[model samples]
Each structure stands twice: as C-alpha cells, then as structure tokens.
Target: MQNLQAKGLSALVAISILFAGTGCQSNSASATPPESSKTLDTAPATAAPAELPIISERAPTPMGEESVRGAPADPSAGTALAQLETIAIKGRAPKTGYDRDVFGQGWKDLDRNGCDARNDILNRDLTNTVHKPGTHRCVVASGVLADPFTATTIHFVRGNATSTAVQIDHVVPLSDAWQKGAQQLVPEQREAFGNDPLNLLATDGPTNGAKSDGDAATWLPPNKSFRCEYVAIQTAVKAKYGLWMTQAEHDAIQRILTSSCPDQPVPTDEGGVAVPIAAEPAPVPETVQDTPTAPVPGPVSGPDVVYKNCTAVRSAGVAPIRVGDPGWDTKFDRDGDGVGCE
Candidate 1:
C-alpha cells in the first residue's frame, strides 16, 4: 500500500512538471512581438532635398526645370487687348528697309545718351554694377544677372574682360515692334522705344540672337517653367508699346498664361508696365509638341520645310530665302553636323 502511494506521489509531481513546462512555452511565444511589428521597426528613413540650381555665364543649362505648382487666373487682359487695337503699331513692317544704322531718328545722340542704354539697364537690374575706372558710368562690375534669354544667370566682369556673353535685349524685339506699328511713332516715342530702360535688359547673347525678331505668335522660351511669366511680360510690353497681335498670337499668349498660372495675377502696366494676360478667343495648355513654325513650303510637298543653312536659319524672313532656291538648307543643322532632316 505504501509503495502504491509513493507511485501516486511520483505521478502527481510529473504532472505538475509537465504543466509548468507547457506554461513556459506559451509565455515564450506571447513575449515575441508580432511579425508585422518587427517589419515596421526595421524599415529605412526618407531622403533629403537636392542642391541649389547652378548659375552659368553664357552656356546652356545642364540643370533642368523643376515642376512648379500652378497659380490662379490673371485679370489684366480684357481692357488691354481692346486697347491694343486702338493703339496701332507705330513702325512700318518693311518689304525693304534700312539696317540698324538707318533710323534717321531722335535723341540725336550717337553714344545713345553719353551712356549707352545697356549700361543704364545693367545699373537698374544688377544689385551693384561696378562702374568704369575712369568714366564712373560704364558698367565694370555687373554681377551675375538672370539672363532671360536662356533662363540662366550670366555674371559680367568689369574693365578688362568684357563679355559679349551679355547683351542688351530689346524687350520688344526691334523687328517685332516695327511690324506691330512702331514706324508710326513720333521721333520722341521712337526714341523711347529704342532706349526705355523698362524695355531693355542685360541678357545672354546667343539666346538674345535666338529671340531675334520673334513675337508671341512665332516663338517662346525653351525653359517650360518660365513661359507663363514670359508671355505675361511680353503682353505687358506690347501693350505698353501699343503693339497689335495677330489673332493666333493673341490666342497663344493668353492660353499659356491662363493654363500654367491660372493663379498668378496677370502682370500689369501698373507699378510701371506689368505684362497683362490677354483675355482672348480661348486658351490652350502648353505642350512639348513642335510649335507650328511659320509656314514653310515643302518642295511644296514633302516632310522638308524651312530652307536651312546658317544665315537662312538665323535670319528667318528677313533676307533672301525665296522658295525654289538651292541655298535652302532645312536640316536645322544648328551645329552643322552633316546629317540633314534633324
């Protein structure tokens, strides 16, 4: 009987030990966090912002545009568009005309005012344009200016090294203004057109040349981000100068400003000639598609449009590029790479 009791006691102890072991196993599993939680704890952190944009003197920007949040509708176009019609383009669009030297014009100042309009503009735009050593008037230390031509910065150094990299851009290209009725301006108004500080800026040379005689209808900035503001400023300048726009050009500028920055107030001639957004037929969103270039006759029919060759390309409608001429080089061979149809 005593031995039976001892066996019973041994069995009880075994059962207790088994229960304790099971309890420990369950506790161990419970102590482990969830698999999902473990994953979250091991995840990596987020990234940082990029460096500031670089500023070059005359070269094209290697750094591209960043997306900008859109703005609201500009409200200055209505009256101004009407005003443009009332205010005729003063200059004549010549079938034949004189070169730059021929404007038997005003101010009668050869140096264009003892101080050229360019130096004056640099003084206005630059933070601190250093003057000539002796003259105390010429820009000797024009700092890096935001060149509107390429939408890049151009730093102008003084005295010794003059940068043709910089140019005085006529806010309204001389030719465009002429076509829009600048020829009718009285000598005084014409002089103002030629010399207005408001109408000129120190810009990148190549881009200035690229802009050449283009109007809103014909061309716009390559940098997509700056287009709206460009159009706005152009609108204001034309409005200020009493320049008229063709139906298409008017529509195009309106479309760009309205679509890109519906929020940015249409710049006004207010506060001294803000470019107003024109309220027109309709607005179109800007796209990367090839802008319809002024009509080019393709052998009267083939993909080949535009008569190419350096001089022809640079001087669009200004010179001798009549149809059926062999001199027509349409490859748009800007760099003169032997390949045509580029």
Candidate 2:
C-alpha cells in the first residue's frame, strides 16, 4: 500500500512539472509583442499637424501703408492666375485730392533713357517705327500700332493734332490706382507707378478714353482674344505696385484667367519699377567782385532762329522756348501752355 501511494505522488509531481514548463514557454512567447501590436507600440505619438488653412495666404487684415510698400520685386514670376491670389481685395478709397499732377506733370524719363516714358512705350509697342531725324531716336515721329484694346491697326503720327490717334494707356489707370492704394505711396513712388512701362501700353486713343479709370470689372479689351493678356497685364501691374483691387475687379480677373487662359503668364520684361531720381540743386556760387563783361544777348525773338523741331532747339541750348521766343511755334507747344518743348 505504501509503494502504490508513493507512485501516485510521483505521477502528480511529474504532471505539475510539465504544466509549469508549458506556462514558462507561453510567457516567453508573450514577452515579445505580436507584429501588429509592435507596430502600434512603435508608432509616432502624434500625427503631423493638418496643413494650415488657405486663409493664411491672404494679405494681413486691415491692410495698411506697409502692405502697399511691400510689393514683390518680380511679381511677374508666376502664372497670372496664381499671382492674382496674392493681391488684396478692398473697397475703393475716396477720390479726393487726386489729380494728374499728383503723379507728375507728365510722362517722366524714369528709365533715364534720354527719352520720356511716352516715347519709350511708343517705341516698344509700335512697329515700323520712324524716329525723328536729329532726336537720336528719342522722339517717335511715326509708327504702326497693333492696338490691343481695339484689335485694329492704327497709324501713330507724332503731332499735336494726330498724336492723339494713338495714346499710351495706363493698364491700371492713375485714378484707379489712387482709389486703390496709391494714396499711401510717396510722391516719388507715385511718379514711378505712373511711368512704369509694365503698366503702360500703346492702344487706340478712343478706346483708351473709353477705359479711363476703369478696372477689369468695368473695362476689358474689345478683342476677345486679347482680354486674357489684358487682364494678365493688369494683374501683374497691381501685384508689382502692391496695389489692391476691388472685389469686383478681383472676381473679373479671376473669371477671365480661370475660364479663358489658365496658363497665361505674367508679362515679365526688362521694364520695371523705375523711380525718378530727383536732380540735385546746383550749389550756390561764391560771390565775387564783378568784372567788366559784355551784356549777354537776350533770347532772340520772332522766327529769326528757325528750329526744325524741339530737338534742334534743345541742341542749341535753348529748350523751353517761350511763345514769343525765336523758333517758338504752336506745333512745338503740345500742351499749348505758351511754352514750347518745356
């Protein structure tokens, strides 16, 4: 009886040992996590933040003078449609205190090319150009303009009566700019804005007149094919000058760009923002004892000194010849302000 009882105890001990070994193996397997659980355990603590909203792309709220001053140097680097996205949309400002003189007396030689902005654009946009004989090609005597606004071929003759046939149209008109953000620009910047060739185009005079002070919402080139380029040019100008657009204007430009010419590139050119340098005032000469000298002859009056044109007059060191001065002719006084070639 004692031997049998001992055998049962031994069998029970063996079974317990086997069960313990199986539990040890199971615990070893569980010590290393399953592949799926391992992946979950090693995963990043947090997801990447969601992309910032599109609202961040807009100009700062309450766009101020600094906004106008922060124009990009090369606003034409991108597609016009994409560039339009960067411009601010705002209501037009009051037109008070706005005048042609607010920009400058007239076209300036901002490029310092020895020619005014008017002639520069004329030379640039016109074909078969004929420059004045002695003007070093500074003065455009005549040219043929493929007028974009009217989609017509127009002859441009530089004369008081005929010059108006082809006029330089401001892609973004001065008044429109003033009402937009130009009111915040300094005088020099305003002058630069007025003369920027990127904003100027040679177009049909009557058509330009019809587009006076009008934005894309109000004016578009009559030629349907040119509208895309026209809007693109306007967008480029506004972007270049840090000028804002009205919501209507923005919408109009957006519609044209998206619907018609999605790939339209901003017209990039050598012509850029050219601010005119102010001429330094001549230093005051030291006073000295007067020496006996011959009386300087006053400007010759009447037609005795006949000048073919203003170029000849300037060459003779007698520009701005007054109405009664020699070589003075009504033809030379384009503005008819009694001053010829002033």
Candidate 3:
C-alpha cells in the first residue's frame, strides 16, 4: 500500500510539470506577434505629395516673339529693353478731364486694312475662325480662344451675351495712359495710342475687366507663365507712347522682367497705318469795308491794344489788366496770375 501511494505521488508531480511547461509556452506565444505584422505596425507612414499646376496650351510667347493676333515683334530685343530703361519714372498726374472722347471715337480703323480694328484683332487672334455671312468678314462668328491671362480655353460665339466673353484689351489702358503723360499728347497722337495693335491684346473679358486701368503695380495676370509676358507688353507700350511710370510701377515691372523675362522686347514700331486728317478749308478773306467807319473804340484800340510786350502795355497806361480785360494777353501774362503786369 505504501509503494502504490509513492507511485501515485510521482505521477501527480509529472502532471504538474507538464502543466507548468504548457503555461510557459502559451505566455511566449502571447508576447510575440508575427514578424510581418510587427513590421507593418511600426513602419512610418508616408503622405502623398501635392499636385502641381498643369501647364497650359496657351504658353506665353517669349519677349522677342509676337503674341496672338497680328501683334508685331519688337524691333530688336536689345533695343526693346533699352527703350524700357529710358522711360521716365514720375508720379502719376491727376485724371482730371479724362474722357473716352478725348482719345478719339473708340476703335477707329486707323490702320484701315479694309477691316475695323476689333475685327482685325479677332481675325488675327482667334483660331478655327468663322466669319459672319454677307458682312465681308467684318464680324467674327465663332472661334476658339486660348486666353493668356487665366490660361483658359474659351469657345466664343458672336452674340449680344456671348460677345462679351472675349474683349480687346488695351495692354496699357487709356485711363492709365491719360495719367502717364498722354494728357500732353495732341488729339491725333492720343488716337494712335488708343488703336495701336502693339498696345492691344485679345483676352478673357473678365480678366480684362478686372484689370481695368491698373498699372503693373496694381494688377498682373494670374497665370504664372503669362506674368512675364504681360509685364513685357506693358513696358513696351509705356515706352512706345512716351509715357512715364510711377516709382512703384517701375520697380514692379523691373522685378518681373529681370527675374523671369530678362530678354523682354519692346514694340517700338508703329503697327498701324497713319490716320487720315481732313485738310482744313482755305480761310475766306474778310470783305474789305469800302467806307472806313470812324474809330469808335474805347479803352483799347485795334493795333495799339495788341501789345507785344508788358513794357508796351505799361507804357500805354494799361499797367495791370485783369485776365478778362481787353489788353490782357497771354504773352504779357508770363505768370498767369490773372493780371497782365506783375
């Protein structure tokens, strides 16, 4: 009985040892997951890179090259750049008495290529063009426009509403021109400035409207690729028209041209034909009075009143005549102080 009890105790001890081994194996398995899964959990995550803007089909032309439409190339790239350097930098003049009529009837056929300026531009710039029937190509019917300002592809059809989709832009706006020395120009020169193709562009209408009369300092095309070209065009126009730039405008333009378009060109050549001036009618000679009327003049006489100098007027007892007085002449009023003498 003692031998049997000792055997049973040994069996019980073996079973306990087996149970202990099984527990250790289970703990080991629980502590370690699969190596593949461990690597996946610990590995660093990578984020996707941002997408870049897509380049457009309407890439800007280089400084030396011509833009869409019959826009002329610079006379010489170096010459164009030199002209830009020559522009006078000055503060803008007040926009007093500035009107569209001051420039001339809008969009005259100054070039008179048998087509109006608007149609000429559309014909020159628009691709896959369809002209209006019975109008001798004076009107654009439909076309595709790859606008440089926003890099937008526009399908244009001529209509009251649709025609506004594309507009002819004055690269240098007339109002901007008015403030930049255009006020000093004669009527004909102002007209030339307005209608010059080198100063014009066909662009998206909204972009043009947004850029209304804004100089380089105020506005630039949104298309990164076109900004350089836009600056070049503005520089060329200002230089060609003998207009000056504000200090801020000059600096901004300089940065753009020097940084991106170092080889920028100017359109110094007049792209359009001379506007015709009607000859003045010959002056009709005043009918000579057969009988000379007795001199009824008072205070101022005919030949003596026309004093060549202030000294002559002073000598004639008309020392200081107000601006509205008969003896007050601009020649004598050097200072324009409303009084002829001193």
Best candidate according to TM-score: 2
lDDT of 1 by residue, 71-110 (tens): 2334555533333344332223442332332222311222
How close to the true structure is residue 168 of candidate 3, measured as C-alpha lDDT? 76
Model 3 C-alpha lDDT per residue in residues 152-215, reported as the tens digit of each score? 9888887644666787788888878887788777778788877777777778876876776778
What 10-residue stretch in candidate 1 is worst by lDDT? 60-69
Candidate 2 lDDT, 214-237, residue by residue in tens: 788878888898998888888888
lDDT of 1 at 75: 56
Relative to the unseen true structure, what is the C-alpha lDDT of residue 286 in candidate 1, on a scale of 0 to 100?
Answer: 23
> What TM-score does structure 2 among the candidates reach?
0.60
Pick the lDDT winner. 2
State each model's CA lDDT, in order: 0.51, 0.72, 0.67
C-alpha lDDT of residue 289 in model 2: 25
Q: For model 2, what is the C-alpha lDDT against the true structure?
A: 0.72
Q: Which residue segments of model 1 deviate by more than 4 Å? A: 1-95, 101-115, 158-161, 263-342
